[model samples]
Target: PPARGPLGGWRKVPRYNALCTLYHESAQQLKHLQLQLAAKEATVRELRGSLARQQQQQQVGVGEAGAEPARSLVESLLEQLGQARERLRDSERLSALRVEALSQEVQKLNQQLEEKNAEIEKMINQPPYEKEREILRLQKSLAEREKAQATSDVLCRSLTDETHQLQRKLASTAEMCQHLAKCLEEKQRKEKGNSDDQIATERSNQVFLQLLCFVHVLLAPEAFDSRDTSSRFRVHTGNQNHMHIQTKVEHLRGNSPGQPGARRTASQSEQTSPPADNGNSGSEGRAQGELRCPHCMRFFSDELSDEFLKHVTECCQ
Candidate 1:
């Protein structure tokens, strides 16, 4: 009977059954030859016994002519026995050669069987469908990995471009800030120079006013005499008028944005003088009438003392 293979089908071993049948046949033939040789030996033994009996008969007065026939028969039996032994020897040699050949063939068959069994085992462990599925899975995984790599490369390039754009924007912003800072510095420098020029002009005006006041005091010594009350009062009023003008000038300078410190210096330099006597309206009326420009001949009221002084300084010049 044929064996079942791993796939539940008949397993075909080529020439195995034929070799087994040939070996059995060879054995049977050898057995049959042995039996035939035994039969031939038994017949030879019977012929010898018969030939011995004939010799005894010849010794008991048998004829020579009859003995010659018996000897010829015995010679023929011996020749037949020798021929049977030679045939048996030939059969045994032939059987031996057949058995050796069969043994070699069986060894070759066993090696082939082992190879077939190995192939069957491999099929049972891993089928064709399973191998194909594994290959497909690996191919799909490789494709997915390649797709992910491509996406990552795109993202990296985009990020690099974005980073470069940000860097450019930052550089432009920094340059604009630097330009604004330089402009601001230049504006501040110009403002400082203008403020300094304004301060110098104000100081020169203050010096000229002081020189004019000194010249007027030197030319009118009798105006400050204590014996003349009306003259003393008028001089005090004029000094008050001068101080009021200085205070107004300091106030205007103080209000200016560029001359914040000038007010303090002007206030520190202001002179303190005695107040005038307010008991003489008649004297005040006469003093106001006499307050006339020496060169321009313009009469001025007491309230317009700063204007009057400016007119007198201009006339003197």
Candidate 2:
């Protein structure tokens, strides 16, 4: 009678049991969606890892390793890598869209529920016989909702575990990639593969290291002092490892976190963790790890891209 069909009708139709069942069913659907989200996230992570490995392999080439060729190849590969990264960005956009849609669904359901409650007020005033029927219908629907909710809870729990595990895997893979790159560089050097070429490769590696550091700083400014200015000394030394990170996170600088500015000494700044703790340490760790971009005077990860984007958007607006 309330006209919203199943949602509103379930309130006055004397099918309490059915209403319970429907609620449970909706809950189940919510859970299924959560699981789907988790699965998609996992897939994205796998894609990132696979792409990284492929890029590395390409950088190394088919065989007979010399550093200059490798370096030039790496530069070339970087351009291709950028395209892959753009693809990943598109995937991220899709995930964001899904999140938005799901949020809208939740909002709509809440509104529908409020409307049902209003209708229930009218039902409560009905004659006893009809009221009893209405109550029973609601009871049934409620039961269904409960069951659905339970299923959803189960799915969400599974997804939480999977995401945590996947995050760990991502961290490990980044570390491994860093190590592999280093070993390859050293191996090429040891073979005396080509000094001129080796020198060029070192230049390329240095440039990569600089970019890595820049990105890290943008992502995890708190992990390293943004005030340190001895760029020459800071790049090679691990002394600033204990300093607190600062940020005006430089995402669009085409700049790495390892800018000459961060190398400056910040004797006045406290070396404490961020008190306004945002849950970014995992990403921070990825940025900080010496292995991934060890020569980094500062590092930023793509994770900070969101925060940086938000900041810039606001500033421009």
Give per-residue lDDT, candidate 1, residue 88. Answer: 84
For candidate 1, what is the lDDT?
0.59
Where does candidate 1 stray beyond 4 Å?
1-14, 60-69, 127-130, 134-317
Give the per-residue lDDT digits (tens) of candidate 1, residues 1-317. Answer: 32455653334354767878888998998899889889988988887777687779778976555334366777887798789889889988998998899899888877766776677677677878998999999999999999999999998888677556544544543454345445434544555657555544444343333334434432443432435654422322245645644553443334333546755655454433223346444553565333555333456654565886787766555
lDDT tens digits by residue: candidate 2, 1-317: 34453335454334434444655565565566566556655765666666576678888884335542345655565566566556656655665666566566656665766678677766665689986898899999999999999999998888677556544544543454465456545655554644544433333343344333433333342323334564322221122322322211111111222334322222123123223224444644554422133233234343454444344333323
For residue 125, what is the lDDT in candidate 1? 79
Error of 2 at 20 (Å): 48
lDDT of each: 0.59, 0.47
Candidate with top lDDT is 1
Model 2 TM-score? 0.24
Off by over 4 Å in 2: 1-129, 188-317
Residue 180 local lDDT, model 2:
45
